[model samples]
Target: SLVPLLKGLKPKWRDSLYYHYFEFPSYHMVAKHFGIRTSRYKLIRFYQFDEWEFYDLEQDPDELSNRYGDPKHAKTIAGLKRQLDGLRTAYKDNSDVRAMPIEWRKKYRPGRE
Candidate 1:
């Protein structure tokens, strides 16, 4: 791991990181989404909402702009998606958010119609 590299040995580094947040009726009103991030880019899919977001970490580090449908980055986004799928399979994450237990809904998202 990074320990080997830190100790003056070679350690193979990964090219990307995968992230998933799947809390519906979220405490902070954040949508459920999954994403993959590399050193230079990040791609997110808000599956339940049918939305996709992408960012160029180099140019838009704040993620102020979404480049998902931008023609110039189509190829890059496609490659990232493939890598994301691979990560999902490797991690055995189905990328589906199961329903929260009813009691949790009452605790976390109470008083909603």
Candidate 2:
């Protein structure tokens, strides 16, 4: 269902290696195959100015909880990080945008100074 929907949403042509590999079913497919139902996909998110968050998709579909720094969900966070890392490696995505220097953002957002 969502697999076909996601595949259909993909662009016909992806010019970048990373983008191209994303076309192949991976994490999303694996999750779907396992029937890991969540109210929303990509529910765990980190914002530029805010911390990470996690949603009890079955309850709070809107993801209003900041479970990032919560000690209770340490295992969940670690597991998710491991899963994300595995997916990245499986896809051969080596980009370190998250590890980029803070100064780099200043270059793009000159007004932030």
Candidate 3:
């Protein structure tokens, strides 16, 4: 159950972990796999370290989250990096998936950042 999985987690840990690893990606993958689209702007945006990210799953499903700049989630972010790397290597995804420049202020908005 969710409780067992999230046991012993601090409230903030639970919030970030669930949001990054489970809730957001789950929603993104299911929607894209079925070709479902929403009018409410389904972009996933997060600030990890210092930079911001914007992912449009209609274009990229494998890359569901941006963990480039968030130090708070460093370990979680690193694990995700390894996971993504393995998946990419397994599928022979040679395309450079490295972070690219984005209008941080515009995409994630100022107050939110």
- Scored by TM-score, the top model is 1
Q: On a 0 to 100 scale, what is the lDDT of residue 108 in model 3?
A: 33
Model 1, residue 29: distance off in Å is: 0.9
Name the TM-score of candidate 2.
0.44
Q: What is the lDDT of candidate 3?
A: 0.37
- lDDT tens string, model 3, 1-113? 46755786544331111122223235343211101112211223232213334333454555566433556656644555455445546656454323324464345334643
lDDT-better candidate, 1 vs 3: 1
Model 3 vs. true fold: TM: 0.29
- The candidate with the higher lDDT, 1 or 2, is 1
* Candidate 3 stretches greater than 4 Å from native: 1-68, 96-113
Question: Which segments of candidate 2 are over 4 A away from where they belong?
Answer: 1-51, 99-113
Residue 68 local lDDT, model 2? 59
- The alpha-carbon deviation from the true structure for residue 10 of candidate 1, after best TM-score superposition, in angstroms, is 1.4
